[model samples]
Target: METDSKISKKTSQTILKLQQNEITEHAIYMNLAKRVKKQGDREILQRIGREEGMHSKLWSKYTKRELKPQKLKVTIYSLLSIILGYTFVIKLMEKGEVVSQNSYALLTKEVPEAHKIYLDEQKHEEALINMLDEDRLQYVGSMVLGLNDALVELTGTLAGLSFALQNNKLVALSGLITGISATLSMASSEYLSARSEGNADAKKSALYTGVMYIVAVILLVLPYLIFPNSKYIHALVTMLIIVVLIILSFTYYISVAKDLPFKKRFLEMATISLSVAGLSFIVGILVKKFLGIDI
Candidate 1:
């Protein structure tokens, strides 16, 4: 026999989970606010934290229990905000907010206050979207250009060298030299391109491009350097796997930060890079077989 004043067992359980989430987020927002140096950023975080705490208190009345924040989760989001930037961390948290949003809809029928909390969550999203104007996000284009070029070019180069050279050290050395040369070439090209386009900070653009390119090159070339000469094939396999992982990770970051589609972007980049590597490997085999050049 259900009554208006009686909370259902299932709804209570959901409220408990939501209560914990609200409190956890309250702690994360407070900690993140402390870490940032910008006054405006701190204020925005503090406001959000206050709202989260208020919601937690609202939930506490229903549960009749005081719940502590998930300290580990708070620490993790704080560290990520530091290492990756507040925008990324906040947007990642926004992804979870969507699930919470859905739960709010379900709970609305059971609890009248749920609707108001749901509206508050919507406001939170709006606030989060408008609050971040980080400078680093502006250079995402340069980073993407450098990272994509390095992955496609170096992945192909290494795949070809693996078969043609049949020696891990030789492949690694060649890949490193090529990677370095390409990094320099890319940085200079980016500098010139930015300058021609009237960008005020062309040097910074070049720096981001160069740094991302070299980072990708290093990750791609490491397996070759680590493997034994007889395991050139293994190195090639490992390098390909690393390529996919880099694509997956970077694509996800861009998707979350920029609010873009993830699956389509990932599939496109992975397809292009892997296809180039595969074709290069085939070319290497044909070159070795037809030319009869023994390494």
Candidate 2:
């Protein structure tokens, strides 16, 4: 009977975990549904929420205990849904369900209801895919173009200027001037390209591209500006770090929301940006040596 007691204790612990997860997910879905404006999307979220609550109840029956939803988890996911869009938060949560599938499989050996809950979890993925129809997803390409160009071009330009000028203040001034001019030029080019392609929202597409580009420029150039009249090498290192962080963050966001491969995309982008910067740095050194010009 001692062996039987240990097995029972382990099973009870597993049931409690499932119970917590189900209740937490139910609150997250319901909170997301409340934020959604579309009736169809809201209804779908509500239906999923109801099903999660039922799953919690099923687990409760075996444990013979009540479990409260994880309030902090629900709050965090709800805030993420508000800021990152419902689709992204839902997809992120669904990724967690993949891990829970193993737990459910273990439970199925003793509890028949666990199998039914596992099947319902599979159905939720399909429903989530169909329900996600956010507008920002459509403009992702334009944003990518803006962000990538700013990172590659500005990083190269700043690296070149840093060596050529050998002064942080001069480098910062030159970078700001070049970045601002490029922002306007890129916006205009995007507008023309969109119009030529017969896109109905040409102006909006251009706006999104331009805004993203400017944001990247500001972030990338901030180090130089802050460290002006001081350590130029330190500023340059900081800027490179910022570029990597930007690439990492944007790649992760795209990978999660669009179901793209993150590692390959991130490595490709980082390699290209750093390669250009390295080439530009070498070119800057050669030009300064050959021309005998110092600013």
Candidate 3:
């Protein structure tokens, strides 16, 4: 490794930033490790944390100045780990690690050690990241089932009801009744399905599914409650917008946490949902025209 004096000013600055990042991640992982109850998880986190510290120390020889962990970053990750779980927080940090890997590539000419660090981070940390297991992630399949079904079913149902009923309160009431009934049905079905599969967490899986389904229901129906009877169209537009936003949000989360492709998943899910709603809206218009229904 070259001396700090020989390294360019720009290179030194980048090294300092990378060093701070490594120390911050070290703090976060160690903090989580201490807080974690599982022995296996604690060991993994501790090992990762120590490795980050080692990276930080290696970079320090170039910067030639001690850098403290960024307190704000550490605090934020700690809080998020508490609220969102360690799995989610660490997965989120993996994005930063990727950027660091890129930066390390750029530094290979000035610092040959950067290449080694990059490879270790890319390979070893990746394996460790995948090794991490959490209880919430265990029921992700159930949550996905709940969210996907609710979005596709309720969005279509609301679009049709908005046109057929032509009254905001009426649409909202119908949506709520339908949503609640479906929630119960979906939950029971999940329970039975999981039990049949011989899964031990069948009850918990059902709870996660029902809870995710109803939450989507509440958000979808909220627009109808807010708009007046005269503005059912506005309510319908808002509900559709909410559906897209929900898809985007959930898709982004899953992509980050599970390392899935975001654009394809988001586009596929959104297309299915909006297409169903569009078909349902046309059916509503046809049904009303043929039956001569009046509000």
User: Which candidate ranks first by lDDT, i.e. highest?
Assistant: 3
State the lDDT of candidate 3 residue by residue for 1-295, as single tens digits.
3447767777777888788888999999999998899888899999999999998999888877777888898989999888768988898998765345567677887888888878878799889888988788888899999999999999999999999999999999999999999999999999999999999989999999999999999999999999889899999999999999999988987887778899999999999999999999999999999999988
When 2 and 3 are scored with lDDT, the better candidate is: 3
TM-score of 1: 0.93
Of the two candidates 1 and 3, the one with more favorable lDDT, higher being better, is 3
Clash-forming residue pairs, model 3 = none
Per-prediction TM-score: 0.93, 0.91, 0.93
What tens-digit string does per-residue lDDT give for candidate 2 at 124-147? 657666666777788899899999
Full ranking by lDDT = 3, 1, 2
Candidate 1, residue 184: the lDDT equals 100
Q: For residues 111-214, what per-residue lDDT tens digits would candidate 1 score against the true structure?
A: 98888867867776576667667666889999999999999999999999889999999999999999999999999999999999999999999999999999
Better of 2 and 3 by TM-score: 3
Q: Best candidate, TM-score-wise? A: 3
Among all windows of 10 consecutive residues in model 2, the one with the lowest summed lDDT is 1-10
Model 3 misplaced stretches (Cα beyond 4 Å)? 1-3, 98-102
* lDDT at 20, model 1: 89
